[model samples]
Target: MGVFYRAPEPGAKPFVAEGDLITRGQQVAIIEAMKLMIPVEADASGRVLEILVADGTPVEHGQPLLTVATGDADRAGPGR
Candidate 1:
């Protein structure tokens, strides 16, 4: 597990948010583990439906950090 950050640094824009369009390999969050900061990215392009983890919170392995609606449609359900 590691501390999660929406924005890696202070004063930086959030990586992702609700209703935001995201692309493949887009950095969505940051995980700080063992004093190292790692980025979490999206596997597919889609619109961000929801954020599952709060900023600065600890996240476990295989945790669902957020939900995305894939494809050109605006479907933000459980499909993704």
Candidate 2:
């Protein structure tokens, strides 16, 4: 429902880059609309395979921000 931003602000480092390992609920990007910064987080723990959105780009609701390669532990379920 807002614009997707890979970085917190222009010229700043992105929250996550390709090949980076991320855990569930980890902030990967932000969505800004009406001056509100909404954090976009990972749904599962995994290695980042790709970033589907560019920094400061506009995005729609349900749009993918990136692709992640889920780890075995993630696929096997929690507490593995």
Candidate 3:
């Protein structure tokens, strides 16, 4: 499973599971900074399996925000 990066504040918009399929730098969610939209992106390619944070929920830096299964079981690495 992949780890989700959390926003650094409370009452922020967390990543969206149904959002666009993103790559390493694609926007996943938005955080309001000075009334500006900050885009969040995926660090790796995978299907989002679950959301750890709720909508409009408070979050902190370095917190887990979601769970993603890479979807490629073949790539699980060295332990097959």
Candidate 2, position 75, lDDT: 69
Candidate 1 Cα lDDT to native: 0.80
Q: Model 1 TM-score?
A: 0.84
TM-score winner? 2
- lDDT string for model 2 (13-61, tens) is 9989999988988899889988899888888888888898777778888
Q: For candidate 2, what's the RMSD?
A: 4.2
Which pairs of residues have clashing backbones in candidate 1? Answer: none
How many residue pairs clash in all the candidates, one count each?
A: 0, 0, 1
Name the regions of candidate 1 deviating beyond 4 angstroms: 72-80
41-78 per-residue lDDT for model 1 (tens digits): 78777888989888899989878888888885533333
TM per candidate: 0.84, 0.86, 0.55
**Model 3 per-residue lDDT tens digits across residues 7-70:** 4455565444543343554566554544555556656666566666655555555555555555
How many clashing residue pairs, candidate 2? Answer: 0
Lowest summed lDDT across 10 adjacent residues in model 3 is found at 71-80
Pick by TM-score: 1 or 2, better one: 2
